[model samples]
Target: MDYIANYVDAIVIGGGHAGCEAALSLARLGKKTVIFCLNIEAIAKMPCNPNIGGTSKGHLVKEIDALGGEMGKNIDKTYIQSKMLNTSKGPAVHSLRAQADKVEYHKAMLKVLDAETNLTIKQQEVSDILIENARVMGVRTITGAIYYAKAVVVCTGTYLKSKIFIGEFAENAGPDGLKSSQVLSNSLLDNGITLRRFKTGTPARVDKRTIDFTAMEAQLGDSKVVPFSFSNSAASIKKNQIQCFLTYTNEQTHQIIRDNLDRSPLYGGKIEGVGPRYCPSIEDKVVRFADKSRHQIFIEPEGVETNEMYVQGMSSSLPEEVQIQMLRSVRGLENVEVIRGGYAIEYDCINPTSLLHSLENKVISGLFFAGQINGSSGYEEAAAQGLVAGINAALKIDAKEPLIIDRAEGYIGVLIDDLVIKGTNEPYRMLTSRAEYRLLLRQDNADIRLMTKGHDIGLVPDDIYAKFLDKQEVIEAEIERIKKVFVGTTATVQSILMAKGSTPLTSGMSLHELLKRPELDYKDFAAVNLDGPELSDEIIEQIEITLKYEGYIKRQLIQVDQFKKLEKKLIPENLKYEDIKSLRIEARQKLLEIKPKSIGAASRISGVSPADISVMLVYMEQLKRTERANDASVS
Candidate 1:
């Protein structure tokens, strides 16, 4: 009997956020893409929170939207609530978050997938990758069906050898009892890929009707909702939003957790994966912060159509009985029934050092990896990587140039660079603090920062590109207008300044100079016939920040210039680090194993210090001068 198998330009393993983004981007770019999943119904499933975007994470969603990805747009369509966080802080930290109707989100994304011309969604577990002579040829599913592909993306997320833990009990399953890809672990190992175990946990889901809203502070979404996509239809996103309640876990809640600590998989040492320190489970919280009397617990509605609510900040793998006890002890959750138990999931991912800046494997040419499979923990982080990997994969097949993002541009760039360079020991999560040039790289300007790249890669549409250009023009005009406006110490201006606690101007000063004062802004001098062009709040914000932090921003830009110098000093693909004189033994060994792309990357790797970078920089410089001298003589 002759058997037939399907062929595609790209095979994306896993239908999670990372896989979905990778598959969609590839298809939209005209590649024949197939997305392999454990369950078709679980496409774009939110295994944990029934929400999207927060702080730095929101920046990612907007950037994805700017790049023509579907997450922000889909989330906007299905969101039950929306809010802008860090309002009291600077615009750089203001993040948009939305509580979504989970079912609707999944359904909406699936419809997009179904409508995509070149993408096929298949319900199958990818068990093995077919790599020959260091280039990916195809993938083999668990059912033994071999799908031929020119390039393959392994976005297995936390599904490879997944283990879910509740208390001391552990079961081999993905987040929602889905089958683990055990065979894939062996396959990755067989290919000489280095592996690491990492863990992430989700809190219990509660019956929404049981929570007492009166006992908690009502958290409301922003009134003027800003959609994630630059192409978003302005057909009013405002609606009656769901309110999340905040309650505190008292001494009793902590005591219950402390008493039952040994029963937790994390505390019991039953789970081996290195979990993220920032998003630790409830059991970890109690153990690490014994002195804290209470912790904030947020009760968030899962969806408008369902009565389920999420118990935030109470994530634990404690015994079921103890979980019920501790949850009930919380302020507003007195009679909360345990609809689902909180648990931690451990899974296998490759040490990202094994991957290149392009998210493609150096050893396996056409094979790429992204998301949790690369040890990054957030949905935003995963999706961002997926876009990069998918783009590079298509470029690989097209024999076009690969895309690489340095740390200065966007958080996505910072994320990939950190993952490949630092080689995280624990599950990597993106934090705004991780970005070196945070002052310039902010959530507010993600579209401004990366939309051009998206356009260049054919991800962003021309209409969106035009809008970005308009936005840039408006910001520049407003800044110029403000710089030209002048104000004097007239009674009107002096009185207004006095009222606002600003020092009286000594003769006359430019309106821009007054704006640079800590107390006054351009908006405050509205009476003086504003000098700069009239601008919207958004554009005004850009003007103010640019004027105020111009010097600091310039300094960081200089640092970026110096950094790129090292980043450009590429390590020869087959350079023998061992042959480099005065290089430390550990440096030589690590350099050989990791095979970093440049001196900057090499400097970040463990055992390679500033001294090692200097040595490498000098060697590369000498080689460069020699090559130039040789070229001059030839000419």
Candidate 2:
């Protein structure tokens, strides 16, 4: 058979959120990159949900934007409704979530990819990765075309040997009924990669006109919308928002699901793959949380032009007839018309432990894996991994140091560390509780934590980086001015304090000290304003957060310093864990399997104990001394 041959700097397989970011990052960095998708129309498609950024997932999107990725900016441009979640909580957990016009979101991302320099988007299925001497050489398409590159990033997402199950019926297909790549799974297994089968489901899409909106509570977008991207202007994204209806599943809905449990593929022992524990199917919820009286269901619009509405919390793999019955049992959805049936998709993913913190494969140099293929669950998680993998793949080809985001820096760091160091048994989802340094890694300050790294890596434009620096300078100057400016205990000041319900000042104090009070914020003191330049809201936010959490931030920073020490203690790539006699049998086996990059990472692994870490540290120190002695003797 005749085959076409092409060459590029990098090749990205799959065109979902992960592949889009990877391709864009590589192209922006001056690398000629090609991203192949099974269907071009599905580029950046949201198969499960028509929205982005929720809880810790928002932090990932912000970090991706800070590092010059496109998800945040795209969502901001195309969102139909936007809101800031967890407002009642501290700034650490506050997240920006937005409901997107699914079609517009895809169009916006596609436009960005199209405009990217040195990037070529192709419609093709990648069948196998080519390797030589355990290093990635390129990838071959199913059509017999070979694409040779310096590096190959597999962002296949949930398409590798994918199977969709709806009750007793099963078919080899990807999300939204797209063709699955059947040959890739075999190719991956043949290349010494350990593959795991994982399952995830999407809720049915119903016609909006059929839903009884008055019967359900109306959920409106925030009047003041918060943009996800630091670079995006909040004013530009603010607009009249759409409404999402909230409905609940009652005893009748539960009874229907309970009666159909035996018919579900999940309960029938038909699904071999492990599904996500956090985002479970309706059947799982009915059985597990049986004590609960009801479950919340969100009816979200798919797009402005379409009548399709996503049934948010009712993801299931029930039979088509049962699904309709299940939908009708709910309050507002009593007469709902189903547009698309919910189903479970099982796909082959590589064991994330096979990769390094940089997201590059340990055995196959220049090869990278991201997205669901890494066992992660959300679009944000996949995009974050894709950005890291793309950046590191380009760095490797350029003979530069690979970029690794540590746990304390951002949610991206915590996510990669958890995946590569502490491998997930099921599909992993990022949560605020997973990150110990959430205060320091807040979504609001993602730019502050990562923009400089992006600039240093050549992804951030010089002008944008200069703007970030200017914002930082303004924040610092305002903080200093506030600390020095003393407010007298005059009648006017006391009255202002009294109006704010704050305690009257007994003596004169710096404005900074007053700002530290729980009830008083920077804006509250405008009545007795001190001299300072007017600042952007962004700058003021940073100043306020820094002052308000100064004590807690300091403590976390101290913890970060301690963490840095262990992280700096690098484990030798060639070190033999089997040779350590003091290590427990399980610890040795786990260590050999994971081959952690540092002492900090090793300590986080489940089976590895504190005693194992201590023994490994001592052995490392002895090895260093032996190497030093040998060098001296040779001299």
Candidate 3:
């Protein structure tokens, strides 16, 4: 067969969310990049839920935006309904979730990718990763075209040997009946990459007109909107939002599910892949949580232009007849008409432990993997990995240091660390509880924590970085000024304190101290402190959070300092675990397999015990002493 040959700096396979961010990051970093997709229209497609940023996933999007990726900005532009979840809780858990017009979100992201200067989008299926001497050379497509490049990123998502199951029927297809890449899995296995089978499912989409919203609880967006992107102005994206409805499954729904349990692919021992534990199918939920009376069902709009509504919380791989039967058992969906039936998708994903913190493969120097291909489950997780992989690929090509965000730095750090070190048995999803440093990794201050790093890496523009610097200066100055400004127990101050239900000051105290009171905040003292310059809501939010959580933040910073010590203790790449006789069999085997980059990551491996880590630490110190002695003798 005649073949076409081309050359580029980077080649990105699969144009889902991960591929999009990876390609964009490379292109923006001035690398000649090409993104190959099975279908161009599926670029940035939300194959599952038509929403972005929920819980810790929201934190991931914010960090991605902070680091100059495009998910947050795109969601801000195309979201039809927006809400801040967990407002009643502390700021650490507050997440911004938005229901998007799926079509617009895809179009918006595609536009950004299209406008990128050094990027080219091609409709092709990458069949093989071309590698030489354990380093990525390029990729070959099914079309027989070979493209040579300095780096290659595989963001195949749920398309590698993808198989969809609905009841007893199964078909080899990607999401939305798209083409699946069959050859890549074999190629990956041939290249010495270990692969795992994982499955995830999506809820069915029903016609909006068929749902009786009057019977369900109406869920509305916040009256005052908050944008997800730091670059977006507060008032710019605000508009009248649409409504989502909530209903619950009754006993009848459970009965139908229970009666049809044998028919479900999951329960019938037909699904070989392990599904996500957190986002389980409706059948799985019923079987596991038998004591629960019902599960909540959310009816979300797919888009403004379409009448299709997503039947959330009811994802299953049951037969089509059973799906319709179970859905009809719900209150508002009693007469629901299904547009698309829910099904489970099983695909090939690599064992992420084979990759380093930079997301580059340990064996293949210039090869990177992101998204579901790395055993992660969500779009945000995929995009975050994509951003990191893309940035590192560009840095590697330019002979620069790779960007490695630590656990203390951001949730993205915690995510990557958990994947590369601990390794997940099933599809991994990010949660607030997973991050030990969630206090410092809040969504609101994502830019404050990551913008400078993004700017240094050339992903963030100079003007935006300058604005970020200005914002930082204002926040620091305001915090210092508040700490110095004293307030006496005067009538005005006492009255204001009483009005806010806070205890009156004993004598006098700094404004910062007053702001630290549980019931009081910077806003309550705005009238008394008339001399201070008016600050934007974003600035005020930072000031308030800093003062209120000063003690907690300081404590976390101390913990971070301790963490950095272990992370800094680099594990020699060529060090052989088999040489360490004191290590346990399991620990030695795991260490030999993973080849963790640092002591900190090694300690987190599942089978590596604390005793083993202690032995390794002692060995490392002894090794260092021996190396010094040898050098002295040679000199």
Candidate 4:
């Protein structure tokens, strides 16, 4: 028997968030790319949550959009309800979140993938990677067909030997009863790739008809919707949105969960995976916070056209009967009929430390990994890694320089750096709190921070890059004008302040200074007229933030300068750390184990300290001196 032969510039294993983005990016960059999945209809499926973007996840979506990825545009076109979370707080925390039409999201993404000129979507399970020596040659599907490629990105998210459990019942299945790739897992293990099992749960989908709206409070989306895509005109896409409901899990609901704790796979020793700490099961929440009498459960619409409502904050793997019992016990859900029973899924994930900063395996060239396969937990997190992996893989194929986002630059940089440098014991998820420089990495400025990189990588179009340049110029011009323009304590200014409920200024100050006031802002000073600088709202956003957080931003900039110095100090790949006598045992062991590319990456490793960094610096200097002496002698 003969098998078919396929060839492509790049191959992506898996068709979820990471795989979709990675394959699409590679194809969009004009590379011939093939994406293998169990089923094409399951492409870009949101198995766990019906929505996209929340808090820092929103920042990732926007950054993905700026880089010419499909997630933001797909969500923007399909979202039923949209919201800007944390609006009451500072602008730094403000994030755009939306409830996407799940079915439509999948359809829209598949359409883009299918219509792309250089991309092919395949329905097959990849069983093993074809490796020549230590470098990835390509992948072999279960049907025994070999497809050769220059690079292969393994984004096999939560489907490798996946098992779903509900109470005492368990079966091999990917999330949502999809086909699980069980054979490919042992193939990876045989090839020396270690596996770590992680667990994630989805909430029950309830029939909207059975829900009692009168007993629950209505949660509405924000009147003004913000599109996640940078390419979108922002104004043209705005429209009327859907509403979500809010219900509470009372003490009765807790009692039902407590009564069946023994039956839960997580509580029982049935699950052998590390679950996400941030998103816990309802059982975990009830047990962990026993003192609390109630917990909030969001009734999120799965889609505007569908009758299924997602039970957020209530994910579990209780038995089907228990699931129904638990749902009915919640206030306003007395008659709820579950469209689908919730369950916990345990699947294989790799230790991210096994990969390099470029998301490629250090031990195996041309072999790359991203998303849940790297032990990350969110759709946004997965997509971010996919974008980076795809970009780097494409660059590798073309002999161009790989893209690297540093920890100080954007959240994507911080996320990948953390994954590679400080490997996680649990499934990794992105949070604003994870980055010290989050204020500088807000969603509003993601395009500005990452668009240039995208442009350089050939994903961002030249016209879009030019537009970004124009926007930057306008922002800088406005800031300059504001700094040069001065305002006096005139009645006009005083009246404006009073009207806006701000304290009246006793003395004159620069327009920039006035804008920096916590009580007074650029919009508040509309009553005062000056020709020095007139800013549009979007442009003023950048100016106001820079002026307001000038001190913090400057301090972070200094920190970044120090970071750059260390990052600039390149560590030779073949250097023998064991020969360095001055380095500490722990530091040397860590440096050799992680094989950090730079002194900066070495420092981020957990056990390595400042003293260790200093020691390494001195050792590197000595090596440089010895090298120079040898070169002089040779001359």
Candidate 5:
């Protein structure tokens, strides 16, 4: 019954967050693309957390929006509650997080997918990826239909041969009981794609009516809302935000988990996949931090239509009876009724070191990988990878150079470079601490940092690009204007400074220099200096940050210059690493396997040492000298 189905310019193998971005980007670039999933209803599903953007994750979301991706816009349209986290900290760590209406988020994204002129959404399980002469040909579905394509992107996020575990019970399924991709792992093995197992867990959902809100602390959303997408302002996306409650796990709850340790699948050796270290289950937390007296738990609504309340910090894999016992032990959940128990899922993912900087496979010419399949753990991480992979796939078909974002450019670059160069033994999560130039890579300036690149790739529209350019010019002009506006020790200026508790100005100082003071901000400067151009809050914020951190920003830019020198020194694809006698055996093995494109990338490899880089530089110079001598003799 096997037959040819259809042919397209590109094929995407999943429909989750990563797959959605991948499909949309390819189609928008004028490529005929088809995205396949086991169930179309699961497209852009948020299986684990109820919200998007937290800490470093918020930066990833804004970066996606800046790159003309859909995640930021979709979240803005559907969020029930939005908050800006870390206001007390520096702007570099300030991130916007929002609790989304899960059902509506999915519907919004699906509508966009359906509306795309060149994109097709198919409900099918991609069982095999057809390869011819080390290049992708197409994919075959479980129903024996072969759909041909010029390029393929494998974004099978946590579904390839997925299995769920709760206590001693196990079932072959994906998140929320969706169908597991059964045979794709075998097809991947057949083609020499290395696969590994990674496990992630979700907490139980209890009925909201059964919980007592009076016993918990009321956690309120921000009074002022912030939009995730650069195109939308706060005024456009404002709504009545919902409220969430916070509770805590006491020693009694910890004791309940400790008593059930023997019955837990995670500790009983029933689950084999490595889980994320950063977002560990309650069981892992209790066992690891035994001395701690309590842990915080947030109760959040799943959606406006659903009564299910997600227990944020209580993810577990114990028996249902133990789960109930632990839930009831918390303050507000004393009489809570569990709608569904939490479970851990183990699924197949690839060794990310197999991918190039563009998310393309080194050995497979037209094959790309992204999201959890690349060993990353968050929705934002997956969507970021998908956007990059989709853009690279289209560029490859158009016979253009690939878009490679390096560590100096943005957080996306740091995420990819960490995964492909160093490789991860556990699921990789993005953190602000991971980026060396985080001060310069703040979430507030993501559009400034990346919109031009997105426009160059043809994803950003001309209208949006023009707006960004105007905003950039306004910010630069204001900064220069502020540098010339001086405030002397007039009675009015001294009174304003005294009211703000700042050091009294003995002599006249430029507004830019005054902004460098820890106490004085742009608003404080405006209060002192009367005549200034009216600028939007967004532009003013950018100018404030630039003047406030000029010295630090300049220092980081110098570091970036030094880093780019090594990056610009390209490595020959066919260089014999073993020929460098000074290199360690382990270094040679790693370099030979990775075939890194630049000395900067090679230096970041885990096994490659500084001494090995010196040897490489010397050997490449010798090769150049020999080539020049031969040319001279021929002349």
Candidate 6:
């Protein structure tokens, strides 16, 4: 017997990183939202890596914050250690990564969700998404309670009929021994949602007391912490950081894994899902890179409260005995006791091509999908999708235009565009290389790029938006001031330049030009002028980057303009690609299947070539001419 329980404007399934962000976004936008999870304690749980943000992923987190998402803010509150990566490279690649206290992070997010007046958190597994006439009605719980909603966002992170495997042993469970949603797969399949089996694994957690830290190199966090959130500052969130250790795997470790290849489920053909190519398991890495003698591994603390340490680069699904043998072969982990052995978990995820750029299903009007359910890996990627999906779902209810961030806008846009167009065969991970205009889509300037959009969508608060606007104004003013502030070829200027290891000025130069020098930086200006605007580190960074990369930025902007033109060449929804006689059979098939919204999107499809794009442009022009002729004849 099914019972009517409650009603809400929207329902978000799965309380993982994606679910938290989606529910919060929907609720904050004045929509009454209810989030369902198998267990309340699992809300925003870091089931795999006990860290957030890395390389390109940091850009996503900053963009998420810029767009009024909770991840960056929550991470700022609960991170145990913080470090900026790729500092030796250009500013474009500089990314902020933080080690999170997994337990505390979860609690902090739950607190935020609890405080949201329009949001409800329920510890119940959603068994079915009730649909009527190709639109979402609500979801039915496992206990046969029907909760109605105008929209539903599925964020089921690795819990849809998930099964964990270790050697030949397997169990029906989610990450960290959580209950898997077994019946929901059928519901999704019945609703015509195509599902794919994808696999991802996590490394073992070793008992901290049993590990030998002396044999490992101590990895320290940055002395001056960098916060992930744009709303936060270095001074505001300073604290004593925790220590992580670095170790490596030797020939012995490799030998053990190679010898036990037959016992490994992945190699033995016991696991059917395709694993991530980038983040492979230990055995897979050793097998794939046979020439490599050693692999780097980081031993990181899970949290301050727990005595378990996460083995960073050593994800495996070998048997317990083999895992023990593998661990003992490593240097510092020679005698380390395993608190939890690593295993790979396979789950059902949808082919992201079925989703629109807004993350809404094309077949089902009010159905949205985000996170791992969209075949994307990593917490940051999941959160980015969640925020967009949540905002779009709310906009749909409000009868407003759906927010669509194009490739030229932010990394979030690039992430979605790739997933929607290319459609990954394996779990998709965000990479800086994936973004074409990475110079414009930097982590530091995420707020400048997308905060306005976030504010216009009713997600960013007025106070925060005001702060962002003020920062923008100050940065612009400072850049203008610097460009006009002339420095003469005085002895004082030469000495200062010489001391800073920069080429002595041959003639008068502006502060902006001085900053462009390879050896000179904005900080060196303190010696030149004491009267310079008292600016925060953030503002100074923006000014320096803007001046240093002015030429490159301008070039990218021009490229972006070209990209946007193709993006603006909208494809008519009803246009039959089969009618375009010039298109190749594969191109026509792909175009018909994808039904891309723009020429730019269609061009990105794997099978669609440049020649096909030219054909499309011609056909569109022909169609326009025919329409114009028809109008003229009627007149």
- Provide C-alpha RMSD values for all models, in order: 2.2, 1.3, 1.2, 1.8, 1.1, 0.9
Clashing pairs in 5: none
Q: Which stretches of candidate 2 lie over 4 Å from their true place?
A: 624-635
lDDT per prediction? 0.85, 0.92, 0.93, 0.89, 0.93, 0.93
Give a tens-digit lDDT track for model 1, residues 1-635: 22237888999999989999999999999999999998998888888888889988998888777777889888888998888888888666778888889999999999999999999989987777888888898988777888889999989989888999998688999987777788899998998898889999999998877877788899887777877666764355557788888999999998898888778888788988999998988888878998888888989888888888999898888888898899999988898887888889999999888888889987888999999999998888988898889988999999998888788877788899888877888888888788778777777687888889889999898988998899898887666665667788799999889989989988988777777775677677788864445666666667778777777889999999988887887787767777679788888888887888788888878888788878877777777898899999999
Count of clashes, each model:
2, 0, 0, 0, 0, 0
Model 2: per-residue Cα lDDT over 1-635, one tens digit each? 52658889999999999999999999999999999999998999999998999999999999998998889999999999988899999999999899999999999999999998899999988888999999998988888889899999999999999999999999999998999999988889999999999999999999998989999999999987778887777788788888999999999989999888999999999999999999999898989999999999999999899999999999999999999999999998888999999999999998999899989999999999999999999999999999999999999999999999999998999999999989999999999999999999999899999999999998888988998998888888888888888898999888878987999988999998888877777877776775778877777788889988999999999999999999999999999988888999999989888888789989999899999999999999999999999999999
Worst 10 residues of 5 by lDDT: 520-529
Candidate 5: tens digits of C-alpha lDDT, residues 325-418: 9999999899999998999999999999899999999999999999999999999999999999999999999989999888887899999999
TM-score of each predicted structure versus truth: 0.95, 0.98, 0.98, 0.96, 0.98, 0.99
Question: Taking the tens digit of each residue's C-alpha lDDT, what string does model 4 give over 253-289?
Answer: 9999999999888999999998889999999999999
Pick by lDDT: 1 or 4, better one: 4
**Model 1, global lDDT:** 0.85
The better-scoring model by TM-score among 2 and 6 is 6
Stretches > 4 Å off in candidate 3: 631-635
State the lDDT at 577 in candidate 6.
82
Model 4 clash pairs are none
**lDDT of the structure predicted as candidate 2:** 0.92
Cα error of candidate 5 at position 300, Å: 1.0
Give me the displacement of residue 512 in model 5, in angstroms: 1.8
Work out how many backbone clashes candidate 6 has. 0
At residue 129, give the lDDT of candidate 5. Answer: 96
